[model samples]
Target: MTQELKVINFMGIRKYTSGFSIILTILAVASIVFQGFKLGLDFTGGTQLEVQFDRPADLAKIREVLEEKQLHSPVAVTFGSDADVMIRTQDQMSIKGREYIAAEIARLGNGASLQDVIRPTREQEGFVDVLVINNLTPDQVAQSGLFDTTRFGKTIVATKDNTTQIAIEKGLDLVYSQHLLKELEVATGASIKLRSSDSVGPQIGDELRDSGGLGMLCAFALVFLYVAVQFQWKFSVGALVGLIHVTIVTLACFTFFQWDFDLNVLAAIIALIGYSINDTIVIFDRIRENFRKLRAVDPIEIVNISMTQTLGRSIMTHVTVFLVMAVLYVFGGELLAGFSKAMMIGVVFGCYSSIYIAANATVAMGISKEDLMPRPKDETEGGADLTP
Candidate 1:
């Protein structure tokens, strides 16, 4: 008679020991220490400067230009290799920066002069200040006039205070801001300072981080409860073990690379949990079926049999799913690239955990005779049915 094929017979290892699980757990802990996960500006709240030029620009050049203005190097990303560039600059709202902006504007153009170069920042109304410097002492004036004005027959008048003022068109010196500060210095003969216009608050990022952790906890606990209720306690325990194992491994990979952890990473984690559970369920279903089919078989051998039967299907399904995720990673654009990457890694490891970790855990979980055997038929004297 032909024998049932042992799918793992060709495979080198069939079981995962406690030692392997312990070692992986240690690695996962160390991951947190060495590779400190950094939050992205998206959840944290930072200024996002979008520059769309007529032509494609290199990131390196863009950074160099921005740094010359004293602006910190922005997190630069291009959407789908598009011509436009997105720059995330450091946050700055200090009085020092605003003070510097005023000084920088004054020295914008050497021969061209600040008046000629610095256009009004406001788009619609122009500011014309009519300061009566002759009548007032420096301390006498409470504040400088911020002239918001329009033109009259003879001269320009302040719209806000009705004071006479000068006309400065907006968007005049802004183009110079787009240029390298070095070029600005060379052309305008002024020392340009990089002013921080925006920064993300720690409160927002901290909230996200806190919520992400909570989300993970909630996700795992709920899943464990459901699986436990649906299957046996042992099945649920093993599934959770497999889950923790794969999650740690995936997180270790993330730490190893020092990739930025953000909302997207959390999304990936949730998705991974779902994906891994599906694999676990598939294997568990097979085991339940095998138990009924081979009631006489030992639990260890039965588990091995179940794993063999489902191996082909698991590999085929995960491979096809992985192929699609790979495509998404390659072409889904920068926004979703990290998410796709995490999913691909999860699929591979989740499959591994199901066969090796989950099955062995079932073995470790002691099985009673009743667990292996079906209930005996009730006789006329049902009480005596306990006889073996």
Candidate 2:
């Protein structure tokens, strides 16, 4: 014998829940429109440095020191651990410097390929441009071109003698990696070892941002097509609305709070679209099944019965997922902070939109038994037919 589920009057308070959803959506839209997002280095194109500290790092003091030294708007935050810090700066190497370095390095030899060039701008002696040249030895590079001159001008060889390592101090006025490392060490009173340094051009960052946005739009359109084929156009619209709700609200939280919106966070939002839609699809499936099974029941009653039956499932799924997201948020470190937070918000609102936003929209659109009824073969060819 099957267990009897307690039918919930889900639609009884639909007005209140619908109003709440509308209010949330409106607030979310307003926040996004006004506050915008705090774009990260990945989107805004800047210099990033990762450093490992001998002890726990003090972010505030580090920022203070950088500011006092006038290091061009440095933003410091703990990365993976208290002992690790990542710093981003608006300071970027001029394209002129990069092109000149690249061209000059290529002139050394046919075998010499320019990999990267980081111009150090610190006032410290022996700190200069770090050139990563592939297929070339340090001695070979040291004996040739700018290196031959900079060697006499007091260039420092900061890396081990290898086929790849080369540093040339042209005594340029720009200050960067070595400068930042010295300042951080003095500020935090810890041995600051440079872990990594990277630079992204503004043009590249803009391209990435545009690609991410286009990817999200494609995701929405594909989801609409999927739901339309699997269920019906009415359910498809509802699913789309639900997805938009989760996305906008998630973005709103980030925008209003001024959280860093980077490529990682964008990826999380895309992942959220799938997760939120799964819940919506589950409810839609149940509603379709009940519409067929309970021929005598009204649409509202059918929805309530379906929701009541799936309540246990929805609760279990959301709780399990939420627990996982909580762990990630707490322990996944600063690099994934935005991603995990976005996921956590998605899981919460995913459940809500699936029930209140998606399902309610379908119901309010006057969904009935006939809309989900089995269709003839010709009709089915043109539309969805859930006939078993």
Best by lDDT: 2
lDDT of candidate 1 vs native?
0.61
C-alpha TM-score for every candidate = 0.67, 0.73
Question: For every candidate structure, what is the RMSD over all alpha carbons to the true structure, in angstroms?
Answer: 9.2, 11.0
For model 1, residues 218-298, the per-residue Cα lDDT tens digits are 888988898877777788888888888888887777788876566787799888898888888888877777788877777
Best by TM-score: 2
What's the C-alpha lDDT at position 173 in model 1? 27
lDDT of 2 at 371: 86
Model 1 lDDT-worst window of ten:
146-155
Q: What TM-score would you give candidate 1 relative to the actual structure?
A: 0.67
| Reference-based lDDT, each prediction | 0.61, 0.81
